[model samples]
Target: MTPRLSNQMEKFYKFPDPPELAVQLRTYSVQRWPTMNHEWRKNKLASILRMKARRLASYWYAEESLSPRVDELEAILALLKLPEEVIERENLNELQALKERVARLEALLAQAGALDLGEQVDGGS
Candidate 1:
């Protein structure tokens, strides 16, 4: 019998994957690395994580106490909860502003394309 699996994944898997949504991020990662360097970067990150684990273990077992800055940051994170309504309101406001700016810029770009290139001004299309 042929085993069936989800088509969400390819027959041959790829590593160090960024989703299709991160279109520009994929390009930036490829540009940063040489050919086959993506695999190397993934391995390097794993090694660094292990090293950090060791450091954290050592720190935890040490007799030394927490630094004031670290303690303060922990407290701040714990205490920083916001109301859901406030967060939703803030997000909606930001999104509306972004949409407005995009609409205005798109309008200007369309106007500029309709005119001579050299005659376009910053404030007016």
Candidate 2:
């Protein structure tokens, strides 16, 4: 059986490695070079983590510092809107009055139409 195995089959049976095993092996092997030592990689990771922590802390600080000011400005804006709210109420009242006037005019027109219809029926007779 060993004698019957081709070179490619022999290597496959000898190593029995997955396809991606070579890629992972080569990546780690390159990192083991003298210039890419373990301590440097550890420090680099530490610095990156520190920078991220500092950024998040600064964001939290800004939000906390500005929260009360934001609330104050919102309160001032509500105060500024008082006059507009009053104007809106007045406009709504005027619209209701116009609607009532239109209803009265429609009722009068309906009565006049009925009178004309009656007159026409009597005249035809």
Instruction: Estimate, for each residue in 1-125, the C-alpha lDDT of model 2 and write its tens digit.
Output: 56666653554443313333323323332343235654453344235334343332332233333222233333323432346557468557867998999999888768868777756655777
What TM-score fits each model?
0.34, 0.28
- Highest-scoring model, TM-score: 1
Evaluate model 1: give its TM-score.
Answer: 0.34
lDDT of 1 at 120: 44
Worst 10 residues of 2 by lDDT: 64-73
lDDT of each: 0.42, 0.44
Q: What lDDT tens digits, residue by residue, belong to model 1 across residues 1-125?
A: 33454443343243222233123223333443335465453343225334343333332233244222343223322322345566468657967998999999998778777885535465454
Please estimate how well model 1 matches the true structure, expressed as its whole-model Cα lDDT: 0.42
